[model samples]
Target: MKTAYEILDVSEQASDNEIKQAYLQKVKQYPPDHHHNLFQQIHGAYQTIKDQKSRLNYELFDYPEADFNILLDQALVSSEALTLSADSFDKLLRASIDDSIFQFSTTHKINNT
Candidate 1:
C-alpha cells in the first residue's frame, strides 16, 4: 500500500524532474553487480509514477488483471483428503491457461524486443 512518492524517497510536492533525479541517484547508490532487488523495486516505482497515465493508475489504485491458477496435484495430497470437485478443477484449469498466456506473451515480447 505504499505510495510511489514514499518508495522513491521523494516528497509529494516533488516536481517531475526532481523525481527522476532522485530515482537516478538512488539507483547509483545501490549495489548493481548482481540482480539488485532493491534497485529493481526503486526503478519499478519510478517507472510506475513517471508516466501521466501510469501515475493516474497508481493514484487510483488500479491493478492489472490476474488469473489465479495453481494446480494441486493429486499425488501431493494425502490419500485420506477429499478430492477436488470437477467444477473447481475446471476453474483452476481456466486460471492456469490465462496465467500461462499472460506469462508467455510478456516473455515473448521482451525477448523479441
Candidate 2:
C-alpha cells in the first residue's frame, strides 16, 4: 500500500527522471541478486505507482490490525513471481485452507484455545 517514492527516499511529486535516478541509486546500494526480498519489493512498488495512469488504478482500503513485516514478506513473494523467466516451470500449485486467506495472510493467527 506504500509508494516507491517513499521506499527510495524520494518525493512523490518527483518526475520520471527523478524516479529513475532514485531507482538507480537504490539498485547500486542493493542489487536484486544481493538483496532479493528488498529488491523484489522495490520493483513491485515502482511498477505499481510509477505512471499516473497506473497509479489511479492502485487501491488501498482500511483493514483490521496488520503486522507490516508479514505483509511486506507476502508482497515480496508476489513481486518475485513477476520476475520468473518464461522458461520457469509452467505448472501451477494451489492449496486451500479454512482461513479466509487460504493461509496467505500475515495476520492469520492460530487460536490454541
Candidate 3:
C-alpha cells in the first residue's frame, strides 16, 4: 500500500524537483553496482513519479480496498501451480515466433546499416 512518495521518502505534495532530489539521494546510498535490489526499487519508484503527468495518472487510478486485496491474493499464488489453457499455449508460441523474427530482422538491419 506504499505510494511512490513513500518509497522515495518524499511528501505526497512534493514538487518534481523535490522527488528527483530524494530519488537521487536514495540511489546514491544504494548504487546499482553495490545494492542492486535497493537500487531497482528506488529507480522504479522514481520512474512511477518522475513527472507530474505520471504522478497524476498513478493517483487517479486508485483501486478499491477489496479490489486491491483481490489483486494481491492473485499475485501471491505461484505461477508454477497454474495450468495454461490451449489458447494461452498458442499465444505463447506466437509470441516466441514473433520475438525471433523481430530479433532476426533487427540484426539484419544493423548489419546492412
lDDT (tens digit, per residue) of candidate 3 on 1-113: 66677789987657779989999899888889999987888898898778644554354353122233332232234223267666764554344344565567779999999
In terms of TM-score, which candidate is strongest? Answer: 3
The TM-scores, one per candidate, come to: 0.48, 0.46, 0.53
Query: Would you list the clashing residue pairs of candidate 3?
Result: none
- List runs of model 3 lying over 4 Å from the truth: 62-113
TM-score of 2: 0.46
49-94 per-residue lDDT for model 1 (tens digits): 6743345344434333311111123211322226667776555444
- Kindly report which residue stretches of model 2 are placed more than 4 angstroms away from their true locations once superposed: 59-113
Q: What is the lDDT of candidate 3?
A: 0.64
Give the whole-model CA lDDT for all candidates, comma-separated: 0.58, 0.53, 0.64
Collision count of model 2 = 0
**Residue 77 CA displacement from its true place in model 3, Å:** 44
Tell me how far the alpha carbon of residue 20 in candidate 3 is from the true structure, in angstroms, after superposition. Answer: 0.6
| lDDT for 85 (candidate 3) | 68
Kindly indicate the candidate among 1 and 2 with the higher lDDT: 1
